[model samples]
Target: MAAMYQVITPQKPAAILKGVGPKVAEKLSSIGIETVNDVLFHLPANYENLSVMNLADAENNDKVTVMGTVMTEPAVAYFRGGKNRLTVFMEIDGIYVKVTFFNQPYLKDKLIVGEEARLSGKYLKHKLEINGQRLIYEAGGGFRVTYPMGKVMHSKTFNKIVAEVFGGFSFNYDLPETVKAKYRLLSVREALRLIHFPKSPADIKEGRRTIKFYELFMFQLRLMEKRQKERVRNERYIIDYDIDELKAFIDTLPFGLTGDQKKCTNEICRDLKQNVSMHRLLQGDVGSGKTIVAGIAAYAVKTIGEQTAVMVPTEVLANQHYQSFTDTFEDRLTIAKLTGTTTRKEKMEIVSRLESGEIDLIVGTHALIEDDVLFNRLSLIITDEQHRFGVNQRKRLNDKAHRKNVLYMTATPIPRTLSITTFGDMDVSIIREMPKGRKPVETYWRRYDEVDEVMASIASEVRKGHSAYIVAPLIEESETLDLKNVQEIYHMFLDCFGEEQVELVHGRMKPAEKNEGMGRFERLEKPVLVSTTVIEVGINVPNATYMVIFNAERFGLSTLHQLRGRVGRSDMQSYCALISDPKTENAKQRIDIMTSTTDGFELSEQDLEMRGPGDYFGVRQSGLPEFKVADLAEDYRILEHARLSAIELSGEMREDA
Candidate 1:
C-alpha cells in the first residue's frame, strides 16, 4: 500500500479507483469528484454514530441501527420519470419497518429477500418509513459519514471505495513547518485521515477545526493580496469634513445617537479622511439608527463637493430611504431617487442631474448602476442591505468615480466573530445599540392548533389602532407541502379581518401590486397585511406592533429575526408570535432562538451554528469566497487565528516584494 503512493498519487482521476465505472465516474463528476484527490478531500455533511436498537424502540427521526430480516422482496416503483423510489419491507424482532431509498432503482438487487440485514437511517416517527436509510453489512461499530450527494450512491459503498484509495493517497497540501508550529496546526495527513475516519467525536471536531483553519488561512491570504493591490491603485478623494462637522450635523438631527451609533459614525468619519480609499461595512440590527449614521457619511461627502449614491435592495426600501434622507437633510442639501418604477422621462432627468452633479445625494435601487446613469465627481457610494446588490453591480457603480469610497450598511446584524472573518477585506464598524424609544418585541411560539389565539391577538392589536403583519411561509421548495398555499391563508385572513382591512403581497406579485399592498398598510388604510417573506426588508411602518409568522419552521433563525424586526420599529409594544409545530431538532432550535432573544447578532450567531453560514445573509451574496471545511459562524475562533496568521504572512510578502 505504501509503495502504491510512489506510482499512484492524487493526480490520477476517479477512473483509476477500484470500483469506479463509466456511470459511477459520471455521477461522481457531477459532485466535483473527478480526481482521486477530489474523492479524498470530499468532506461529509455530517456523521451519525450508529446506535443499535430494535424497530420498536426507534422513535421518529432517530438515527438507530436496525438489525432486521428482509421479510419481503425489494419493490421499486417508478416516480415522475425514469427515477424510482425503492422500498424494502423488513422486520426487526417481528416489528415491521419500511426502508425507503429515493432515486436508487439499483438498490433493489442489493436487498435480498428472506435474509438478515443491518440498516442505519433516520426513522420517521408515527410511520415506519426510514429516510436516508443505508444498508450496511456490519451491525454497528463506527460513525456513518453522510456525503453531500448521498442520493446517487450508498455511504457504505463510498466508504469502501475511499478506504482502498486512502491506502495509497498522501495528504500533500501542507503549510510551512514554522507557520504550522506557530498556529498549532495539524499535518494534512492526520487531518484528512481523522476527518474521514475519526476514532472519537473529539477527533472529528479537531479534524474539522484544522481543515477550517487551512481553508480560511488560504482564503485570507488571497483576499489580502487583492486588498493590497486595490489600496495601491485607488486613492480616496480626500473628504473635507472632520469629526467636528459630523458632530454638528448629528446635533441637528431629530434624535440623539446611541453610543454604538456614535462610535460607528466616528469610525466612518475617520476612514473618509484617510488617503486610501475607504471600504467599510456598517452593521446594526434593524431599526438601530444605521440610516442616520449613513446620513452623516453622505452629508460629509456632500460637503466635500462630491455626490453620493445610496443603493438599496428593493424599490420600497429605496423610497423609504429617500424620504428618510430628505427629512434628515431638510433642504441642507439636494436628494433624489431613481427606481425601476421611475418613468422613462423622469429617469432621464434624474440621470441628467446626476451627470451634472445637480443631485447632491441620490437614493435608488439597482437603477443607480445603469450604464447610461453617469455621476459627476462621485466620491462615496453607500449600499444599504449590502447583500442585495451583486458584486459586479457594486463594482460597476463604484468604477464611475476616479477614487471611490464605499460604505456598506446592513441592518442584518452579525456577531463580531463573523463580521471580522467574513468581511476581512473591509473595515467593520458595529452599531450594537438600538435607539431609545424603540420597544422590545414580545415573542411567542406555538403550534398550528393555536392559530385561533394568535388571530384573536392580532385583532386586539388592530382595534387599538395598531397594524399587524400576517407573514405566511410559501412552501415553494417543498413537494410534501405543495398543497399548502399562502394565498389560501391570505383569503382566510381576509374573511376574518375583512378584505378592506387585509391586503396580500408575495414574490410573484407585480412591483406595483405588492407596493400598493404594503403602501396601504403603511398609510394605515389596512390594519392587517398578509405577505410572504417578500416583505422581509420592505416597508417600515412604526404603527405596526403585531407580527405573526405562520409555519415558522420554514425560516432560518436569521430570517425569522429579520421578519420579526419589521415590527418593533416604534415605541409601541410589539409582538412577534412564531407559529409552528417543528418536528426536527433544528426547526425547534430556530423557534427557540427567536423566542429567546430579539438580538439580531445573537440570532445570526445561532443561525450560523444550526445552519452553517447558509446563503441566509451576506456570506454568499456579497461575493466573498466560501470555505470548504471552515464555517465562520461555528468555528469563528479558528477564523480569527487564520486571519491573524494570514495578516502576518501578508506583511512578509509585502516586505519581500
Candidate 2:
C-alpha cells in the first residue's frame, strides 16, 4: 500500500472557538468578544442599514453599497522630483466614480484587471493635476460589494465577520414564555439577527429595547438570588440579659439617647437576646453617637459573663473607642485594644486576656480578627462603618465569635427603601438626633481669596480655648494639582497661628507621630490640626468647633460631610468652612450641599443621585446593590420592581424552605 500522507484541516479563525492566539484574543476582548457565547452576546452598540440607491440619488456623504467593477487598475502618480502616490480609479455603470488608495506601494499588485471587491467609506471629490496629468476625481461613498443587506455591525468592528455561515443563520428562535413576559424581551437569537440585518428600521429599534431590558433583568435576577441566600443563612443572636439592666444603662448615660438611637439599640439588643442570632446595621449621621449606642449593646451582652468585640475601620476610630469605653464603663468593663501598632507581646497579652474573659470589651481595627486572637464566650460583635468590611471578612469575624450577635455601624445614611430591600438581613436603626449640648455644625462655602478670613475665624475660635481642624484633599500635591501639600499647609497654618499652636498629621506619618498630633489636638496643646482625610472618621474633639477644608471640590460630598462632622461636638456653636480654589459655579453647587443642610440622610440621597449608586457606596461593598444600567435615584420604578420582585421571590422561597 502506498504511504498516504494524512491530510490535516487547519482550523478557520471563525470555526476555532478555543485555542485563539493571545494577541487575537486581546483584540477580541477589547471589543468584548471572548467566548463563543460572548460573541453571541456581543450586541451591536448601534446599527446602520445601508441605503442602496443609484449613484445619482446618493447624497455626497451617504454611505451606499454601489455595485461597481474596476474600470482601470490602480495607478501611481509622482509629483515634483520623486513623489510617489498610488491611486485606484473605478466606476460603476453610467456613473463616474473614483477610488484612491494612498501611499500603498503594493496596491498595484493587489488590484487585478477587472477584479471586483466591495469598499465602504465616506465620499470625497477633488480635482488634482499630478505630473501634468489632469484627473477629475469625484468621491461619493465608501466602496462595498452587494450582498444580502441587514447585518448589524459596529462602525469600528466592520469587516470583522470571518464566519461563512453568517448569511445562512436564521433568527426567530423561541424563548421561555416566563422570561419573555417578565422582561418584555425578545429571544437573543432574534435580537442578534435583527440588529445585524434588520428588515426595517422599526425592527432595529424594537430589538434594541428588548436587549436593554434583558440585560437589566438578568442583573436584577442575580441580585435577587444573593438576597435569597443571605436570608437563608440568617441568624439572630441569643441575648441573655435582664431588660432592666439595659434600660438602666441607657438612663444612666450623661445625656438622654435620641428616640431613634434608643429604638435601634433596643431592636439590636432584642435580636441579641433571641434564641437564634442577630445581624443588624446601625446607620446614622456624622456625630450622631453611633459608637456609644453600640457600646451599650456590647455592654448588655457582657452582663451575661460574655465578652464583646468592636471593630473599627481605622486605628484612630479604634483608639477613640478604646478610650471612650475605658472611661464610660470604667472598671465595670475591661477594654483592650488590638491594632497593627500593638507589639507582639502586647498582642499576645491582649489575646490571653480575651480568651480568659478578662477583657469585657475589646475595641480595635482589623487586628481583632487575626488568627491567634480568640475570644472566650464572645456574645456580641460590633463593626464600625461596616460597608468597608468585606462580606467574607464579616462572616469570619462573626464566626470567630462563633455566631454571636452582630451590630454594624455606618455613618453613611442609606435610604429606608434601600435599607429594607438590600439590607433585609439586618434590622436597621437610625440615629436622627444629636446628643444635647452638641451644637449643629455651621457650614460655609468660600472662594480662595476668603481663605484668610476663614483661617482668622478658626484662629479666633482656637484663641478662645476651642480647637480647629484643617483638612486638605491630599497628603501630597500631584504634578497636575497646584494645591498645597498637607505638610506645607501645616507650616502655613503654623506661621499664621505660631509653631506651637498648629500640628500636622497625614497617612504617611508614623503611627506614633499621628497619635502625637491627634493627642496634641485632643489635649489642646495644638488647638489646630492640619491633616488629610485620615482625620475624617472617629476623631472626637468636643472642643474642636471649626473645620477648614482646603480645595473642597477635590473631595466627594460624602467624604466632605464626614470631615465636617469632626466639629460641633461640644455645646458651643461650631463651624465648617469649605475653601475652594479657583472656584466655579459647579464647585459652589458641590460645596453648597453641606452648607445648605445638616441632614445627613438628605445629603446621602443627593450624593447617591450625583455619584450613582455603585460609586456612592463603593463598588466592592455590601451595603448597596450593583446596578449597571438602572439608576437607583432616577429609576425608582425599576428599583421598586426589583425590590418587589425580591420580596415576593424571597417570601416564596422561605415558605417552601
Candidate 3:
C-alpha cells in the first residue's frame, strides 16, 4: 500500500515551503496537513462564485467576493470570554462595508485606511456586514475555492499553496487500463488537478465523478472477493427450522405482527433454514420492532438445540436486551448475559453453562468475542447496530469450526440501492411499518440562544408527568471546543431541577454508573437523564417523551437519528428539539433534514448526499477498504456502476487465477 503514494522521496514537510514557518506549520498540522502531499490533497469544502457583487442587489447571507477600499481605521471590539473582534469599515462602490474578524488582532495591519483589497465572506443586506472575512489576493474572477479552513489559514492561502504545488507538474497513474476503461476513469494526475483547482464547472463534475467511482469500486472489489471466498466454505450449521414451529412461535407473540415485520421475519427464517450459511442484513426504522424479528430468529435457532449469540455495542444495551430476551423466553428457553461488567463468578458460571449446553441463548457486548467464550452448538449470531463491530469481530463471536448463519441488524435505515451496493454480499430485509402502540417521534431545529424556549417546552411536558433527555457532545469541557459539555449542562439542570430529578451518563462513565443512571430514568426515580450519545442505541424508556440535543450539529445524521429514537417508544407523542445554530450551510441542511422527517432511511440518504466517506465510518467498519472521496449518498449512481464492474472483474480475476 506504501507504493500507492507517489510523493517524491524524502517527503518534504509543509514548513519547507516559501511562506510557511514554524507557527504556520503548527496551524497546518492541527488540521492533519504536515506533508506536501497533505497540502496537495486537502480538498476544497465547496466552490463559490466570488464575483464582485453590487451592494444594491446583494441579499442577506449571500456569499460574495468584493473589491473594496478601507474607509475607516480598524477598531478592536471586545466580547465575552476575552474574545477580541476587529472591525474595519470599507467602501465598495461607495456602499458601506462592515468587515469583522474574530480573535484576529493582527489582521488590523493587513487592511490600511485607503488601500483597495479583495475580501471574501458572507454578505448581509441589512447591516452591510461581511462575516468570516478573509483577505484575498487572487482574482480568479470566475470561481474561488473555499476550504474547510483552520486558524492562521484561509481558502486563499490554501489556493496559493495548492497552485504552487500543482503548477507545471502532474502525477503518474497506476490504475490498470481494463479497470480504467470499464469505469471511464480519468488519469490520477488529471483527477487530482481538476479536483483541487478546476478550470470549469464541468471539470469539477467530471473529476468528482471519476474519483468517486474509483473509491467505491475499490471498496466493492475487496468485499466481493472476500465474499466469493466465503461462499465456497462448507456450512457447519445445517439444522433446519420447522416451519410449523416458527409459525406457532410467531402466533404466540403478544400482539399481531405488522405485515412488513412478519415478512422480514419469514425472510430471515428462510435464510437460517438453508445449508449455506446465511449472511443477511436486517434494517428497520426506530420503533419498527427489529428486536422482535431478531428474537423470533434467535428463538427458532434455540429451539433446534443450538446456541444464539447476540452482540451489542454497549453494556447498557446488552443489559436491556438481556431483560427483553428473558422476558420473552422466560419459561420457553434458558437465557443468560455476559458483559465486561459481569462478576468473575457470574461470568465463569455463564461460560460453563454456555459450553455445557445449559444456556440456549446468550446476550452480550464485546465480551462475547473474547477467546474464553466458547459456544456448545453456536449455529446463529445476531449483531445489533452491526456497523459498530468490524466483520472479523462479528465472525469471531460465532463458532469458527462451523460457518454459522449470521444476521446483522441496524436501526439506521439506508436506501435499498445503497444497501445493495454496499452490502451486495448479503441479502436484506427492511421493516418500515411500526408495531402497534408505537408512535412517531417529532423533531425540530432551533438555535443555541433559544435554550429558554426549549426548556419551556420540556417543562410543559414534565408537568404532564413525562420525562426528558438532554444530550451534549462532550463529557467534560475542553478549552479548544466551545461546545456545551455534559458536566456543565448537568450542573445547570441540577441547579434548576435538583439532584433527585436529574442524573448524568456519558461514554466515559463506568458501566455500573451508567446502569445506575439509566435505571433511575427507566423507573421514574430521576425524570431526566443528562447524557451523551451513550443513549443513542437500544436504551428504552417509554416515559421519556422529550429529548433536547445541545450542539446537535456536532453529530452525524445517523447518530442524531439514533439519539432521537430514545424517545417516542410508546404511543404518546414525543418531541426532539435539536438545539443548534448551524454555522455552515451544510450544517444547517443536516439539521433541516432531521427536522423534516423521522424516517431513518430518508435522513441517511440526505446525509450521504451532504457528506463524504470520511464523515461516515465508511467501509472500514464494514470490513471493506475505506474510500478517500466517494459518498454513498451523492455517488449512488457511481456506486451502481462500481458494484457491477467489481463483480465482473472479480469473476474474471478468479477464473484467470
Best by TM-score: 1
The model with the greater TM-score, 2 or 3, is 2
> Which run of 10 residues does model 2 get worst, by summed lDDT?
1-10
RMSD of each: 7.8, 9.0, 8.7
When summed lDDT is taken over every stretch of 10 residues in candidate 1, the lowest stretch is 1-10
After superposing candidate 1, which stretches have Cα over 4 Å from the reference?
1-173, 176-179, 189-209, 233-236, 242-245, 415-417, 475-486, 491-499, 618-628, 631-633, 652-657
Which residue pairs of candidate 3 clash?
none
Cα TM-score of candidate 3: 0.68
* Model 2 Cα lDDT, one tens digit per residue, 361-452: 89888887788889988878888888788877777778887556777888878865466545765667888888876777889888877788
After superposing all C-alphas onto the true structure, candidate 1 shows an RMSD in angstroms of: 7.8
Q: Which of the predicted structures, 2 or 3, would earn the higher lDDT when compared with the native? A: 3
Which residues of candidate 2, in runs, are more than 4 Å off?
1-37, 48-237, 415-427, 436-439, 476-478, 582-588, 617-636
Instruction: Note the Cα lDDT for every prediction shown.
Output: 0.79, 0.69, 0.79
Clashes of each: 0, 22, 0
Residue 257 CA error for candidate 2 (Å)?
1.9
Give TM-scores for every candidate, taking all chains together and pairing residue i with residue i. 0.74, 0.74, 0.68
